[model samples]
Target: MAKASYLAGVALALAAGSALAADLPSRKAPPPAFVPPPPAFSWTGLYGGVNIGYGFGASSSIRGGELLTQVPGAGPFAGAVDVAAGAWNMPTNLNGVLGGGQIGYNYQFSPWLVVGVEADIQAADLRTSQAAGVSYISPVTGAGVTGYANANQYVDWFGTVRGRLGLTLPSWPNLMIFGTGGFAYGSVESAHRYTRFDGSAPLFATQASATTTSTNTGWTAGGGVEWTPMAFPAWSLKVEYLYTDLGSINQVGTGFYSAGAFGGPATMLVTGNQANFRWHTVRAGVNWHFNPFGSSAPVLAKY
Candidate 1:
């Protein structure tokens, strides 16, 4: 009976120990929770913006040979005197304020590369004028003579259509540097006038004027840096520089005549005058982007 009780007690103790082990919590940690990856930033979108800036280096010239042709008696003396006498060239260092707006779309080809097309128009106040005089003796009468010329040129407005290539910084994807090139067009006004004097008395005067207000086509190139803030991904700020050339302008002025002491009234015409609109501009602006992906939300990443 004692051996049976001892064996029974040992079996009961073993059963209780087994039950306790079963009730205790697991020691191994639960499998780690599944994590979702974070979304990446993208520059793909349609954008529009406004800009303000300054322009400089608007240089131009007037053909001298053309001016001589406009003179009534210029053909006969063409070989006797310098045909280039009435011709003048001037560099108008035009510097002024400009403001405008732009619209475009961008496609992010890769994490670091982006391409886009943009168009912009601006109103400008760039103008300048100069006057010059020369003295000479008339080949026909051997009389002392003097000539004076005045010129004025201005660019009223300009526009451009361009393609852009950009690269985002490896360290900061929000920052981008870009280059652009394409077609340029603008409106320009030019005026030229010349006056002749014989022995201190007024002889004759001629004037010419032209306008490219319809369409002036040329080429343009530029580069810039842009930044988008983390808090406002849809908004961006940029600083840019551009060089534009609007080809050349040809104009002819009306002729006028006045009588001299020795000869009948001489008629004069001014021709072969050209004005070139080449300028450099620096600007800053803000843009609003219409992103299709979503709000400027930050991307989340999985560890």
Candidate 2:
């Protein structure tokens, strides 16, 4: 009877222990692998991206172009007459859209300062066309003269190599504002078409046209604000404004005329067309960073 009581007590203890084990939690599949948060946001990295923007030319900023007239049919003139050259103002609205890609690197040297270098190339259709009557008193004889001028200017493509200096906002860790300036260059084209009429008769005239294209080098300066979203740590967004010089393109036309100043077909008349271009651009862009928040170097490539 004592042995039976011992066996019953042992069975009761084993049942209680099993119930306690059932109440306790299991291992939970190793706590779901302990995922860590993303690293801190940093601008120290290499990035490449694309952008689209509008470009506007300041007609007033363009100077040094020749706006002049051809020789008029002065009765009883003995020699081939020359005309004076003056500055021409492009008509309002030398503006169009532009788009391109950029590559750059940034290094956050201090808590508030970030410096970097960037290169970009763009294709554009920012153009200006004007046809007007230009009048000026002859410098040689003080005679009033009126002539026609026609011009076309274009900023076909442009690029820049610039240095950037940024200021980080303490309140917004992901936002930064920066100033940039450096070498600017582009392809500029201009064409001038002119018809010079002799005397008061509009039906009688000579026509000459010339076109010029050149790659001009100048300077650019601008500022912008950039932001890196927490949700996209490897991508950044920016809105920027820049003012760049469009360089100079000129056309000088010298064609033999059949009749001018009683000089037959071999008579020579010169027509000059000149202009310089400068403009402002506003752009919005996004960049993809490589090796973000890594070592001091922004890019993974070798130096």
Candidate 3:
């Protein structure tokens, strides 16, 4: 009877353990929680901004020439040409500050690449002037005569339409380095003047001035760095350098040497200069983006 009770007790104990085991939770691994991927660094947006900068002119040399156009007697001198000043090539420089606004659009194809187009207009104050004078004894009347020639180039305003290619590093998604080039256009003006005078008894002077203004077109190329601050995701700042060429200016001026009381009236002269406008500019600017790196962006970045 004692042996029978011990076996029965062991049986009951095993049954209890089995019931407890059935109530316990399963040991299989739980399904992973849904943790979505990080968002992409997108530069896709439309932007507008203002910029200020300084420009250094690379205008090489001014070529000048003069011709004798009119005389008192209407003889061979009516169309006689001298071109004595043709041998002159005067060196000059032009420089100034500029400020303007720009508008552009950017599309991000990948996390590391962006392409865009931009257009800008600027008001500028780039200008320079040069003058030369000479004194000589008149071969005809043995009198002293003074002659002067002055020329200048001024860029009143300018603009550019460009295409840009930009690169972003994976480690620095908010920073981009880019290169740009395109068509450039501007309003340029040139001034040419001439004067002739004598201090003798037939004291007289003749003067003339001419200006040529035109809208010129050329090509421009440059590179720059742009950054978007984490605190100001809707704005970007940039520092850029560009080289621009806006064609050239050619002008013509006229003047006359008068011998009013010297018993003879004298000759007429034409004078002019040709100069080019090219410059390098360094600019800094801030832009306001319409919607960049927003919640609705298409990229679900996996970095």
Over 4 Å off in model 2, which ranges?
1-38, 60-76, 87-93, 135-146, 200-203, 260-272, 296-303
In model 1, which runs have C-alpha deviations exceeding 4 angstroms?
1-38, 63-86, 200-214, 292-303
* lDDT of residue 296 for candidate 1: 36
* Residue 54 lDDT in candidate 2: 99
The better candidate by lDDT, 2 or 3, is: 3
Question: Which digits, one per residue and each the tens of the lDDT, describe model 2 over residues 1-303?
Answer: 999999999999999999999999887555465445655566888999999999987653322222233345533343434454453454534689999999999998776888999999999999887776655664533544455667778889999999999999656767889999999999988777666554432334566677888899999999999998878888899999999985676567655545433333434333335577788999999999896674643333443
lDDT values, one for every candidate: 0.73, 0.73, 0.79
Better-scoring candidate (TM-score), 1 or 2: 1
What is the per-residue lDDT of model 3 for residues 67-133, given as tens digits with 9 covering 90 to 100? 5443546543443333345635677677999999999998887778989999999999998888877
Candidate maximizing lDDT: 3
> What is candidate 1's lDDT per residue for 255-287, written digit by digit as tens?
544345334444455556666678899999999
TM-score of each: 0.78, 0.75, 0.78
Clashes within 3 Å, all models in order: 9, 3, 0
lDDT value, candidate 2, whole model: 0.73
The collision pairs in model 1 are: 38-300, 38-301, 64-87, 70-268, 70-269, 71-268, 71-269, 72-267, 208-253
Clashes of 1: 9
